[model samples]
Target: MSSKQRFIKSVVATAKADAPAMPWARGARRAAFIAKRSGVEMDKKAA
Candidate 1:
């Protein structure tokens, strides 16, 4: 599978296996992952 798909699957698996203590924590994790992925895409485009 593609890296992006793998990453998403891993995230889903983690979410299912371990419940977050707070809803905001899950949101923060998702936001951070998106930010990180976007930064990588930007770098690829810039290159």
Candidate 2:
């Protein structure tokens, strides 16, 4: 096998853990994530 194939084989050999859930799972986390993503200043008391 070529070097690329060897690299892919190595990558596939490793068992990675499941990815974490999205940050928007909670109300506060969702608000903060949305504010950061949209470049807006969120008011905590407004909600």
Candidate 3:
């Protein structure tokens, strides 16, 4: 799988395993993951 796809799958797996506390954390992770994958920095406005 591609890095991006792997990242997404991992995030989903994590979310499923830790649903309660994973909501915000999952969002944060996804934002950071997306930024890293796209070679861009995450901005507060976008987050």
Best by TM-score: 1
The candidate with the higher lDDT, 1 or 2, is 2
The best candidate by lDDT is: 3
* Candidate 1 ranges beyond 4 A from true positions: 23-47
**Considering summed lDDT, which 10 consecutive residues are worst modelled in model 3?**
19-28
Note the Cα lDDT for every prediction shown.
0.69, 0.73, 0.81
Residue 18, model 3: Cα distance from true site in angstroms: 0.5
- What would the TM-score be for candidate 3 when compared with the true structure? 0.40
Residue pairs with colliding backbones in model 1 are none
lDDT of 3 by residue, 1-47 (tens): 89999999999999889757554567766887778899998877766
- In model 2, state the lDDT of residue 33: 75
Clashes of each: 0, 0, 0
Measured against the true structure, the TM-scores of the candidates, in listed sequence, are: 0.44, 0.34, 0.40
Ranking by lDDT: 3, 2, 1
Residue pairs in collision within model 2: none
